[model samples]
Target chain A: MSDSPIDDLIQTMGLMWSADGGPRIAGQILGYLLIEGEPRTLAQMCEALQISKGSASTNARLLEAKGVVRRVHPVGSRQDGFLAVPNPSHSLLKSVAKRLRVQADEISDISARFPDERADAQRRIADFAEFYRQSADFMDEWTARIGPARGETAQES
Target chain B: MSDSPIDDLIQTMGLMWSADGGPRIAGQILGYLLIEGEPRTLAQMCEALQISKGSASTNARLLEAKGVVRRVHPVGSRQDGFLAVPNPSHSLLKSVAKRLRVQADEISDISARFPDERADAQRRIADFAEFYRQSADFMDEWTARIGPARGETAQES
Candidate 1:
């Protein structure tokens, strides 16, 4: 805690990047947005993180693309507020669904490609992917029952 | 989904890389080891993965370091038994503990570094890390009660 908001933000970013999701600058941005529970302007974000204007732009855009964060526009104002998805757990549910669908497709393609040659291995892979979908669904239901991770403020959770 | 054992191994590696644990190459190795079930020689692993001999050695060493895979010596043989740890869910308990310990210490340092000036930001960062530890503890306990994942024979469901 360097007694500055900027230092704290940087520290949070470092911690998030060190986690499982990703070890990248964009991850840092998402972590900050997700945990802060506040909407911040682009300039404010850049200033707090002591990053260049261009770098902030790129990182913010990346976060938005991930669907974990979004750009919000205030009433009658040009300044954009970059806010994290209001419901972190629910968003994760959606992500799980999308990722599982894609993986299932991949597994299907793999099974088709190999035919009978590596049949056992291919079957196992597809089965595992299906299991993954089950696991994700399990998490979604669990979260819905428990709560939307601490800061999400989601109603259902 | 290719029936090719080799392709499955590669795809398995990619899946582990994207899983709940950090993106670990050692985990990739572990997945392949699990699929083979029977222990493999280091030479076989190197050939299948298409990596250099040195890469296989180093990566195997890394997997061994993580406690997710083991190097066992078969009876009456000098060569080691390259096998996965068998039950990964319990292993996750230990890994989560280690990761959370590091996170706790890092967040403590951040708290110390921050003065009273940026109290809100400092609080946000601290809580974010605190929640991660709480989540880890919860998941670990749940998994322990639920038994193992990744094809382990469940002791109890």
Candidate 2:
């Protein structure tokens, strides 16, 4: 166990993200970027986090795709760098809300195929679908109040 | 792929929950209980889900611990059974909210230890902590409006 506070934060994030089925290294990179508050080269990340170059590069791209981080061209550096986006938790929450909506759709689709005799199952399925749908809506409202996600315009279409 | 609707639902839940770092079998069992709408013996679960008795027993216990299901004594049956609680998704959401709160706490604790030289990191850490805290609060309010979780009283102290 490291006595460093930054290490503790990195490990906390790594564990949390891994628990959500995300790569632990991605969370660690996010943590590193969060505290460093600057764009970091892939090599710098590998050196600081003690991770392989390939792992750092892959997870950095993953985080970029998730909108939790953005790629940057660091001055006087050959390699591109990654920086944590402002309010990254919102981006992560937005992805979760999207999944909840998908789950709702899947339940609704399956529920439509039930036989007439399976009334109980139909009712239960409807309830489950509604819960997920409403949860997604709630999340949308919450994230909206927090402001637009990275690269998103505040103006409603 | 199976053309059965329940099978589709089960697979969907299995994938979703497993993606959230839960046991796939547990999600399958939850889906089974959701559509079945009744208590199921471990033997019946093993037979219908085609899972090993050990897997059925373990996952059932895990679900019960998560408050998504409850153990019950089946009439005229020596073996105990498990039943899905009403609105099990609420329980799952509640658990997620609790985790968000924990993350907020961890971030806050680490932020307090930052030195005067780390003003930028402190500001960013504060934003991250606030997002998690508010998100958790939003989830709690939403779940409360939806009604009490299984075994929870509606009355607030």
DockQ for all models: 0.26, 0.71
Look at candidate 2 and give me any clashing residue pairs.
none
lDDT per residue, candidate 1, A1-157, as tens digits? 3555445545556565556565456656765675565788878777766777887788787666555577777898788888766544445444655665566565555555655766665565555556545545555665567564433432321
Alpha-carbon shift of residue A103 in model 1 (angstroms) = 4.9
Q: What is the TM-score of chain A alone in each candidate?
A: 0.67, 0.90
TM-score of candidate 1 against the unseen true structure: 0.71
For residues B60-129, could you state the per-residue lDDT of candidate 1 as single tens digits?
A: 7766665566677799987776876655545545565667656756765666566677576566656556
Off by over 4 Å in 1: A1-9, A18-23, A27-38, A65-70, A84-134, A148-157, B1-9, B15-28, B93-101, B148-157
Specify the CAPRI tier of model 1: acceptable
Q: What's the lDDT of the predicted structure labeled candidate 1?
A: 0.61
TM-score per candidate, chains pooled? 0.71, 0.91
Candidate 2 TM-score versus the reference: 0.91
